[model samples]
Target: MLVPLTRQKFNQLIPLIATGPQYKYYWGKFPDFLQRLLISVVIAAVYVLVRLFAMPGFGPILFVLGVIGAFYWLWGPVFWASMRNAKCRRYKYSGFFRGRVLDWWITDELIGKQETVDNKGDLVIVENREKRINLEVGDETGFTAQLRAPLRVEHKVIARGQKVEMLVMSNRPDLSKIEEITDIYIPSRDLWVSDYPYLRRDYFPEVSRRLRDRPSERPRRRRPPEEQKGRRVEEWE
Candidate 1:
């Protein structure tokens, strides 16, 4: 279910948007069939070894049970992963439906802070704010929306009765944890009006370019006021 939020509510949820690090999957570049084939081979060999060596005939001889487990992993979990990707493709690139938000809230968790050397080799401390939205769609549909960030939130204020669009995959109508929250709910995302970014916290420095460690060139005197870009700049050279 997609609920329409008012513009005000949308803006309020900005700061609470969550984000995290981006990890590259080892087989990300491989085609789906190749990746599945590789996984099947690896899983088969690993289970065969475990069944031969590790399994001690404690009670009722573990003959083919491990083999069954391996097959289940390949067919059940692995197959579902492929189907989930397909569903996402259909809903994201295909069409979507407009619905109203049933209810929503922000959830925050600490990912810890770390000190790192920047380009200048100076030690800098970085703190990450990780958050997510637990929203349920009702009053229109029964789908639920959840997202883990490196996520961008809607800058437009969302209020009750505001119309929101949700991506729909007719083949697999499950929307519990597959759809992108921002892409489906915020129409402006397709427009890029929100100045605030939805990106990985680790890569955030690239977006805003934060200066850390050994930065004393910026003058701290009382010389300010240059209308270069049509407006008086606060920190000027």
Candidate 2:
């Protein structure tokens, strides 16, 4: 299922920039207003220090840095999405390939420790562990790849021998080879498991269906010549 990068597809993907679990896991730790307040305080403190010391030409530099930081903090997700989308365009061609899960395993990774006051009024360190699932998948072409993603509840249903689909990029027009592969999309569960989100969920299904329904191409065998037909001629001595 070859899907070309188009303006329409790109537009469809824009809305999903900060909507995935990967983004939520990190940014959700703090409220957006609190994060904004922290950034503002940091910028104001830097400005105060620069002014108090009377640093020559540092005011303009601080202003420039503040603007850049503010822009990034506010629109970082969209900026990142645009950059990644641009990078993906270089692949030019991509196909949706179906593969079966050969094996899978779960691991608990320590993300960080947080300081908290337990009900006892004593400060305690709470460990934050993110459950991750590692999967091994292989397709008919004998191409196998491993994918790792945060183990959300929807992914708990994954088991060995389950069919999964992924979008593979290739320079070849026929998609004869795999250059890179995106995260796996589990149709049965309507779930996408990946460290990063790549495809437009709303559009991927329609493209996959169209490609699967299209006729496959195969070379026709050459027929024997009329003179050579119905005869077993001996090799020249």
Best by TM-score: 2
lDDT of 1 by residue, 108-177 (tens): 7667788899999999999876765544443333444433333236633544444444333322122222
What is the lDDT of every predicted structure here? Answer: 0.39, 0.64
Candidate 2 lDDT (Cα, 0 to 1): 0.64
lDDT of 2 by residue, 33-110 (tens): 477557766776776676677677787887777666655445554556556656765675554567688899999999
Model 2 lDDT, residue 120, Cα: 90
Candidate 2 lands at a TM-score of 0.62
TM-score of 1: 0.30
lDDT of 1 at 191: 22
Report the lDDT of model 1 for residue 14. 25
Candidate 2 has its poorest 10 consecutive residues by lDDT at 228-237
